[model samples]
Target: MSLRTRFTEELKAAMRAGDSARVSTLRMITAKLKDTDIAARKAPTDPGVSEEQIVAMLRAMAKSRAESVALYRQGNREELAAKEEAEIAVIESFLPQQLDEAAMAAAIDAAVAETGAASIKDMGKVMAALKAKHAAVLDMAKAGPMVKARLGG
Candidate 1:
C-alpha cells in the first residue's frame, strides 16, 4: 500500500489502541503533509505530493526533532528531550530502512562515478544523482559533506 494509506490505517490503529503519543505524532505528520500538498496544489494540477516527497518531509521532521532533542538534553531538559525522542520513534515507523555507513559510502562512490564528478564543481551532479536514487533512505545532510570530501572540496 501507499505510504499515506498505511499512515491513515496506522492512525486508526493508534486511536483504537489509545496510544496518545503515537496518535499525536501521526496527526502532526498528516497535518504537515496536508499543508505541503495544499501549497503544491496552489500551482500544480496533480495530487501535489509523491510518496518520496512525503518520506523526505518525514525525514526532515525527524531530523529536526533529533537536533532539538540533543539541544534539550544539553540544556538539562531531559524530560523534553525524551518526549522528542518518543516523537522521533513514532515518526520513523513509516520511513524505509536507513542506509548505514557502508551503504552510504557505496552510494557516494556510485554517484560520483556515474556523474564523473572530478571536482567540487561537479558536487551538484553527484548530490543530484544520490538524491534521485536514495533520498528516502539516506541522510543527505550527513552524506553531503562526505560527497564533498570525496570530490576533494
Candidate 2:
C-alpha cells in the first residue's frame, strides 16, 4: 500500500485499539500531510507530494519530538520527556529502518563515488545524491559532516 493509505489504515486501527498515544501521533501526521497537500494545490501543475515526501515529513516529525525529549529532560520534566520518547516510537514505526554505522559509511562512500564528488566543493552534489537515494533511512544531519570530511580530506 502507499504510505498515505497505510497511514490512514493505521490511524483507524489505532483508534479502534484505543491507543491514545498512537492515535494522536497518527492524527498529527495526517494533519500535516493534509496541510501539505492543501498548500501544494495552489500550484495546479505541481504534482502532489510523493511517498518519499511523506516519509520525509514523518522523519521531520520524529526529529521534532526528539528535540522536545532533550528539552524536557534538561528541564527535569521526566514525564514529559518520556511522553515525547513514546511519541517518537510511534512516529518511527512507519519509517524505514535506519542505517547503522557501517552501512551508513558504505552508503556515503557509494554516493560520493556515484556523484564523482572530488572535493568539498562537490559536497552538496554528493549529499543531494545520498538524500535522493536514502531519504527514508539516512540521517542527513550525521551524514552531512561525514560527507564533508570525506570530501575535504
Candidate 3:
C-alpha cells in the first residue's frame, strides 16, 4: 500500500484500539506530511510531493525524535526521553529496515567502486551514488564518517 494510505489506515486502527500514544504519533506524522505537501505546492501544476519525499520526511521526523531522546536523557528527564523514543518507534515503523554495520560497509564499498571514488575529494560523488541506491535504508550521518575513513581522509 502507499505510505499515505497505510498511515491513514493505521491511524484509524489506533483510534479504534484506544492506543492514545500511537494515535497521537500518527496524527503528528499526518500533520507534518500535510505541511510538507503544502510547502511543495509552489504552483497549481506541481505535484506536491513524491513517495520518496514522504519517506525522507519520515526519516527526518524519526531523526529529530532521536536527537530529542538524547537531549532529554542528558537532562535527566526519563519520562520525556521515553516519550521521544516511542515516537521514534512509531515513525520508524514506516521506514525501510536499516542496514546493519556489515551491510552498510558493503554498501559503502560498492558505492565507492561504482563511483570510482578513490579519495576524500570524491566523497561527494560516492555519497550521491549511495543516496541514489540506498536513500531509504542508509543512514548518511553514520555513512559519512565511514566513507571518509574508507577514502583515507
Query: Largest lDDT belongs to which candidate?
Result: 3
Per-residue error at 4 for model 1, in Å?
Answer: 1.1
Error of 2 at 70 (Å): 0.9
lDDT of 1 by residue, 1-153 (tens): 998998899999999999999999999999999998997785666766998889889988999999999999899999999999999998888899989999999999999999999999999999999989988888888998999899999
**Model 1 worst lDDT window (10 residues):** 39-48
How does candidate 3 score on lDDT? Answer: 0.95
Best by TM-score: 3
Task: Please list the residue runs of candidate 1 whose C-alpha ends up more than 4 Å from where it truly belongs after superposition.
Answer: 43-46
Error of 2 at 49 (Å): 1.9
Estimate TM-scores for all models.
0.89, 0.88, 0.94
**Where in model 3 is the C-alpha error above 4 Å?**
45-47
User: What's each prediction's clash count?
Assistant: 0, 0, 0
The models' CA-based lDDT, in order, is 0.92, 0.89, 0.95
Measured with C-alpha atoms, the lDDT of residue 83 in candidate 2 is 88
